[model samples]
Target: MTDGPATRYARAARTWAPIDWWKLEARAVYERPELRRALAPFAPVEAWRDLAKDVATAWGILLTLSHIAALTLPVLAGGMLLGWLFQRDDLAPVGLTGLLAGIGAVLAGIGLVTEAREPTGTDPRIGRLIGGLHLVPSTLGLLVATLAISLGSADAPLGVVAFIVDVGVGIAYFVLNRGPADSGSDRGRRNLARLERALGELPPTDRARMEADAREAIDVLELRDLVGADDAARAREQRLGLLAMEMAPRTDLATQRR
Candidate 1:
């Protein structure tokens, strides 16, 4: 007999009604040697494993670039203004410093935009590089401004005040934009938790992939009952049903109420 929509629907309904059906399918996919071998070619073990890591890395890079750009613009602008105010006979060095810093800031802004568009990854090394880049420029700008105030033959108190303001602004920018570092274990745990939540929201037929992801996540979290107990399972199924109902073509609810 040909399998039609009715047969598929019946199978889905039966599968959805029992958690054991889902669990058995999951076990079969992993434990059955023939099924595993047949599925090996289509499995995206690396891509699925690396998805969270990529996202975290991308976020870290974007934030770092943004924070650096914020600090860079103000420092460059203020430095140029200060240099203009002090217009000594030798304006070359100060002018060049301001110009170079301004260019660097613009380049950093471009980098930020590019990084924002790129896909994220979960590499700690990449995150560290991004984080370091964010802090390095601002720190250097602060130091340079401080040195200029101390060494320059300008209005001493005014120079000091400007330097302090510039440093303060940079510090504030860093504080506001900095994101937490991604530890390898923590990233894995968070990704797993997210996968579990996503799996819990899917219908039985549509949930096979999500269930696999949830299993991987559970393994990462070392949780025995990531999907919880009978009550939790029922609640999850109800939630999925409600979601499906909402997605279905709408009829007049008022007529039904009557």
Candidate 2:
């Protein structure tokens, strides 16, 4: 029999993707203690491998959103205008591809915003599962752009580059949301070796900043200190808080919830 999807997806998630400029950009979000201090966990740099994946996952969010805006506005407004002015209903939607792109772009924006919101709830695992679902249309417009390019083939120069970036992001989300079974309890503790490698790749100051962020994320979110807390209740607060930070981001929930 063929390998199960879990086995396969876990393998694919482990596979090093062909393009990774996004990982660098995501990591840069943590370059300074000033920036790190402002993060969801007070310093979410402490989360485990999956949350680590969250680091890589945010790369194309802004670019993808901007890319969709660039493509959609021109085609949507221009196409409608051309269709109306020339009295050719036939011109509307370029036979429906433009319409699909427009719809997908709007839905994709909503999905991406959901993906960006940090989880705030009694159980973060549930929030992560929901937030992960949002990554789809979050990346949908880019996929539509890829499809639009494939269907049109005339916009090759920029479209080709977007196609590659889209593929890289696809790889990222697959790894992030579809990996092997996870309790997500291992946020900071689950993937120590990989985190170490990532840490090793950083400059000395950047590495120092991560350490600082871990300490700060707890305070920023009003979580008790996990290691130093004297009792179970405080440690539970830290545990839940880190899980909440790892799961999602949106609308400065980071500042308001705490």
Query: Mind giving the per-residue lDDT tens digits that candidate 2 earns over 1-258?
Result: 223221222233332221111122233333332222223232233222222343433433653453455344434533443443346332223324334434434544444344444221112343333333333332443444444445553233243333233334434434434432222333222232333344345566654444344334323223322223332234234322232333332222223222
What lDDT, from 0 to 1, does candidate 2 have?
0.34
Error of 2 at 52 (Å): 13
Model 1, range 6-72, lDDT digits (tens) per residue?
2233233422323332332233233223222222111223322222222334445655555555545
Cα error, residue 160 of model 1, in Å, equals 10
The regions of model 2 sitting more than 4 angstroms off are 1-194, 202-258
Quote the positional error of residue 51 for candidate 2 in Å: 12
Cα-based lDDT at residue 126, candidate 1: 42
User: What local lDDT does model 1 show for residue 113?
Assistant: 49
Per-model TM values vs. the true structure: 0.32, 0.26
lDDT of each: 0.37, 0.34
